[model samples]
Each structure stands twice: as C-alpha cells, then as structure tokens.
Target: MIRAFRNEDSEAVVALWLEASLQAHAFVGKGYWESKVEDMRTLYLPLSEIVVDADEATGEITGFAALVEDFLAALFVAPRHQGKGTGTRLLKLAQKMRGTLELSVYAENERAVEFYRKHGFKVVGQGVEEATGHLELTMRFGG
Candidate 1:
C-alpha cells in the first residue's frame, strides 16, 4: 500500500533511492546517479512531501515517490518491486492532490522516460543540469 511518508520511513526511502540509482547507473553513469540522490535531499526533501509504498505482509518499504508543489520530484521503486505498478499508483496519488504535475528526468534514462510517457506525462522542454552534466527533459501531466 502507498501512504504519506513518515519521518520513520526516511531510511527505507533512501535505501530504495540508492537501489534505483544503482540500476540507473548502468546506463546513466555512476556520477549521474550520485548527483540524482544528492538532488533528492537538496531539491526535494526540503519541499516536505513524499509517499512510500509498503509491502502488505512485511511492512517494508518497497518504493517511494515525492512531490514539490505541482512537480513530481522523486519516484523510485525497489529493484525487486519493479513492474509491479507501485510507482504508477504513487504518482496517481500525487496527481489527485495536485491536478497538474511536472518533473525533470535525465534524458538518458529511456526506460524512465517511457514509463512516464505510459502514465500520461509529456515532454515539454529540455535542458542541461550543471551538477551532473546530464541532459534533462521536463515532462508535465494533466491539463
């Protein structure tokens, strides 16, 4: 089940991010993955909104997603939980709270791009991130 993030969930959430980042690193590079995690705390955590997916049986966090205003800031699912729809469910919850949403994603991460697109996100613009020297695409959802 997906629920609002509690302070207690930080450790699990961070772990999920690290795991997802490691998977992303295979294609995006380790430096880019590291910068993404750094951006999570620096750019998203301060915004004070996140949601976590918990395993019903174990109660262990399986994934997490966060939002800042109308922007979807972070969305990571544990490697073991991928393709199980947890990320999409969390995103739908975020969208329910904010009718519109936007997010920046690394352009090199095609799987993520396709995932977002499958969930109705559309690329609206592109830019370079100074911190990671990676190209980013800005995608938006809703009207």
Candidate 2:
C-alpha cells in the first residue's frame, strides 16, 4: 500500500535508497553513494514530500518516491522488489495526488529514462547537473 512518510520510516527509507542506488547506478562508485547517505537523510528528504510503498503483509517499506512541489525529486525501489511494479505504483500515486509531475534524470540511466517515458513523461530539455557533472534530461508529465 502507498502511504505518507513518517519520521520513523527515515532509516528504512534511507537504507532503501542506498541499496537501490548502488544497484541501478553501478557505473558510479560505491563511495559516492555512501557519501550521500547523510545528505539524503538530513537534507534532501527533509525538504521533499515523501511517500512510501509498504508491503501489506510484512509492513516493510519496499520503495519510496519524493516530490518537491510538483516535481518528482527522487524515487527508489529496493533491489529485491524491482520489476514488481512498486516504483510504478508509487509514481501513479504521485500522479493522482499532484495531477502533474516533472523530474530530471541522468541521461546515461537508460532504464530510468524508459520507465519515465513509459509512464507518459516526455523529455522537454537537457542540461548538466553541477553536483554530479552528469548529463541530465528534464521530463514532464501532464504538461
């Protein structure tokens, strides 16, 4: 089920992000991801509106999506839960709640680009992220 973020869920959510990020962005060094754990916990997450996907039976969080205003700031599904629709479900929930969503994704992350396109987001612009120095595409849904 999809639900609102809880302060209590922070630990599980951060751990999920680390695991999923390490899996999805294997091109990036483990140390890079590890270094961001603190910022993800204290800085980014606190600034976004977060929602989590919880297993109905175990009540464990399997994935989460974060939104800032109408833009999707982040989404991560546990590696064990990949290809199980957890990320898509969380994104659909975001669409229902916000009606429109926008995001920027790494140009090299083909899987994520395909996923967003499959969900009706279209690339509107491209740029480089100063933080990672990675090429990125800006995509938007619902105009």
Candidate 3:
C-alpha cells in the first residue's frame, strides 16, 4: 500500500535509506552515509514531500520516495524488499503527482542510472558532486 509518510515512519525510512545507500553507493565511504543519517531524519525528510510503501498485511514500510517540488530528492527501498517493483511503484506515483520530474544520481551507481533511464528519465547533464567528488548525472523526465 502506498501512503503519506507519518512521523513515526522516520526511523524505518532513515534505516532503509542508509542500508540502500550503503549497498547502491559502495564507491562512497560508509562513514559518509552514516554521517548523513541525522540530516536525513531531521532535515531532508522533513523538508520533502514523502510517500511510503507499506506492507498491506503488516503495515511495515518497505520503501519510500521523497520529492522537493519537481525534483526527486530521494527514493529508497529496504534492502530485503528491493527488485520487487516497489521503487517503480513509488516513481510512478511521483510522476502522477508531478508531470515533470528531475533528479541526480551517482554516476557510479549504474543500477540506479539504468533504472531511471528505463523509467523514461534521460541524462541531461553531468558534474562532480562537490561533497563527495563523485560524478553525478542529472536526469529529467517529462518536460
């Protein structure tokens, strides 16, 4: 089931973000993701429009997407629940909410880059992320 993110979902959401980040962004140091946990919990998540995918039977949050206007700030699924269409479902919901969407993904995270591309997002620009000195690709969908 897809639903709005409640305050109580903070812990689970951040945990999933951390785990997924660690797995998908292996090139980045683990400490970097760990250091951002508090910011994700208190700053980023709070400031974005977030939606969660919950288990229909247990109501456990399995995945989530966060948006700041037309920009997809974050999308993550629990490591255990990935590759099961949850990410696609969340992305479709985001598309329905905003006809145009933009986002940046680490260039080294080929799985993510391919996933976004398969979903109709095209790489429009590229740059080095100052914080991590990693190549980042800017992708756009719709207009």
The Cα error of candidate 1 at residue 135, in Å, is 0.9
Cα lDDT tens digits, model 3, 1-143, are: 99999999999999999999999998999999999999999999989999999999998899999999999999999989999999999999999999999999999999999999999999999999999999999999999
lDDT scores for all predictions?
Answer: 0.83, 0.93, 0.96
TM-score of each: 0.88, 0.96, 0.98
Tens digits of per-residue lDDT, candidate 2, 30-98, equal: 898999999999999999999999999999999999999999999999999999999999999998889
**Candidate 2: stretches off by over 4 Å:** none
Q: Which candidate do you rate higher for lDDT, 1 or 3?
A: 3
Model 1 clashing residue pairs (backbone): none
Query: Runs in model 1 with CA error above 4 Å?
Result: 31-43
TM-score of candidate 2 to 2 decimals: 0.96
Please report how far candidate 1 places residue 88 from its true position, in Å. 1.3
- What's the distance in Å from true for residue 22, model 2? 1.0
Off by over 4 Å in 3: none
Select the stronger candidate by lDDT from 2 and 3: 3
